[model samples]
Target: MQFTAKFNALAVAVVAAMVSQVAASPAPVASVVSTDEFLKWLDTTDADITYIGKPINGSVPRAAQDVMVTYCNKRTQNVCGGTCTVYNGPAACLAAGGTACLSATANVGFCDRGGCGGSCNQLSTCGTHLDNGFCFTPGTASIIVPPS
Candidate 1:
């Protein structure tokens, strides 16, 4: 019947629209940075680093390092200091330790010593922080990969 034919045509049009919408949507992306790149940035900025959402430079090396250690739960503590290395996320870096590590792809909180925490990711919040006491802030200067 004509009614059946028209219904089928409407269904086809709906499917096509759905397909177009999916294609038009932006692809999911994560920003990843190498340890070497982060270290270079740290050197240039002297631990005065900040990101897109965070107001002021987030150069708290101790906080970042502690979180990485807890997430990775590594027996050794060599990854935090000396030489630049790549890190995927806090958990991956903590467990692997200086071996081109990767982190949780999504849905994670970055916790500080006093329990101050924030969300983290590859592109927006991906990177390490350092505090070497050279910047003259308080403790050590923190370094992090600047958000893109």
Candidate 2:
């Protein structure tokens, strides 16, 4: 019957429209939490935390170009644990001592020397990704923070 044929055509058109919409949607991007939230998280962690740059306070708004990096002294299984240093500030070479692993809100570079003047690797190209966005970066003695 013509009614059945028309109904089938309508269904096909609806499905086509849905498919197009889905295909046009943009891919999801990684999200970074606010400074306040990050501070709250830092408080909850058991690892010893040290700050290297700008002071962190609830009333102070984090710089837009700053990146939060947390480097740990140990990695067990796929976790970055032990004494950790939390760096929250602008782009600069960070002296990270005994850092075996690290995590960051944005991509950064890790180096083997104290001044970031040796072999370097980007976090985006991490070979050993640990739990919760942490990467295994053994022998890292410094970090290069790129401007955001």
Instruction: Judging by TM-score against the true structure, name the best candidate.
Output: 2
TM-score of every model versus the real structure: 0.24, 0.72
lDDT of 1 at 137: 10
- Candidate 1, after superposition: displacement of residue 9 in Å? 1.8
Q: What is the C-alpha lDDT profile of model 1 across 76-146, one tens digit per residue?
A: 22232223322333232121222222222232323321222232233234344223211111111122322
TM-score, candidate number 2: 0.72
* Cα RMSD for predicted model 2: 4.3
Q: Best lDDT goes to which candidate?
A: 2
lDDT of each: 0.31, 0.81
Candidate 2, residue 7: the lDDT equals 100
